[model samples]
Target: MDTIDREEVDEVCALAEAGQQDYDARFELSRMLLEPIEDEASDSKMIACCKGCDHCCHLRIEAYEFELDSIHAYYLRELNSEQQAKIKEAIVERYPIVKDLGDQEQRSINVRCPFLIDSQCSIYPVRPMSCAGYNSCDDSLCKRSNDDPNDTSFGIPQDQNIGYMKMRQMALVQMALDLSFEEEREIISGMHRRLFG
Candidate 1:
């Protein structure tokens, strides 16, 4: 948590430098990989369905070191002093326990993300790829999330949007790379390193 470990930050940067950064070559990687999603995001279906719904925003999410680093780097350069301080305060205040917990505990944040502000994400542009990618369907997961906005339980995955789930595996890789965690903790850090860092 000490500012997104420089090592982790370097991994993604190295990837980018080597030109092997997951989807860095394609600026529209998220939009393309999750293609068809671009239109779906704005289409009446998802737009109308998700209006006034902060289900995904409230759910606990996790981030991979690379993805987290990607976000952190973006924020390091993009945000103003006031904005950075505000997000830092929010992150530290929201995850007070993580702040105190040893590296072990910090690895897995089992609380609502500190990055979430006013129930709406404050950092939308520099948000992690995961954030830009996550989309809830009319599936059981969506139903459960809508029913309990505060629920932290894992939801059922959609048949079509499996890519989102796959990308999430990188989070595990990241955590494993940084902390040799034994238990599967409950914190979620879905992207937005800018707001949540």
Candidate 2:
């Protein structure tokens, strides 16, 4: 993984702390920071992820509260009432199956994310930073991992720079939200609470 630049992180954090940027701006900043890195990685022709690949969506996803809030807002603003209802129903049904699962079980199971519709992410534009940061260089390896839970090889190739930059951007967001890392929660449960409660 690439080393995080302390100066870059500090600058973002300072802007966040100054109360100059809202959630949208913060997320946009994250996108701006990641764009060049993703472009460089893509030029290598090693990125295997594509629009119809939802294998990774089955994995457990954790995100900060602010990230979840951003998704929720997007769902409410961009989707119609029927679409919202369907996703909420899916979350309600899936939550019980996943709510009590241990971390390992959650990771091993293939529960589709509530936002996944017809094998595509319905909230792609506002996907969490964790999702934004994830990349794979081998679609076959990803399929193997997703197809068989016992396949614990985790041998998928990834761009370390993308992951490291995402971590730093997340730190900047945390500082902006005045939240600790511990505030992060499982995505399904977070959405369940947001939609139902």
Candidate 3:
């Protein structure tokens, strides 16, 4: 796995500081920080995730406030009224059940992501780090997990640097927290707040 260099981390921190109020800069920084994880996943042959493979899309999609802001921008600027209405409908259907639940509970809700269209992420380019971080070598495990929420078979290999990715996520969250950004929120609630608030 490629270790993120200290210099890179510092650069990301600088970007986060400067871009706290700049949505595009913050979004770009998020993607840059995530590049190493993607590279490592590719190196390990564990990055089998692709469009139309929407198993993980059913899992809770968590996002930082800035990331949610990016998605909301895409939602307003890109989606047609009908598309937006359909997503809002999905949220209306599922948000009630998952809204008060904790993060882990939200993940087990088994609802397709509101932004999933024809089994592809409608906001792929600006997807949150949480969504971007989830990579699995085994498609079967993804299927099983999607089929049975209780099944523990769904897992990415340890060699994929999940721990490293998680640590990087925490660092980013801490940076955001220091800047008074909301820690994180599940996709449905986050989007609802972004769209309606």
In the range 1-197, model 2's lDDT, one tens digit per residue, is 44446675676565444323355664564455556455655655668888899889888888776568767877877778877888999998899999998778987777888888888888776677778778898988888988997787678799777777677666665554566656778999999998889
Task: Indicate which candidate wins on lDDT.
Answer: 2
What order do you get sorting by lDDT, best first?
A: 2, 3, 1
Q: Which lDDT tens digits does candidate 3 get at residues 1-197? A: 34446676577677767676676676677667566556665666445676689888888777777667778877877789988899999888877877898867765657788999888888777777777777777777778888888766446444447547756665655653453224677889888877667
In order of appearance, the predictions have TM-scores of: 0.49, 0.80, 0.78
Q: What lDDT score goes with residue 165 in model 3? A: 70
TM-score preference between candidates 1 and 2, better one: 2
Question: Candidate 3: where is the Cα deviation over 4 Å?
Answer: 1-23, 153-159, 169-182
> Judged by TM-score, which candidate is best?
2
In model 1, which runs have C-alpha deviations exceeding 4 angstroms?
Answer: 1-15, 18-52, 98-110, 138-159, 162-197
Q: Count the backbone clashes (under 3 Å) in each candidate.
A: 8, 0, 0
For model 1 the local lDDT of residue 12 reads 41
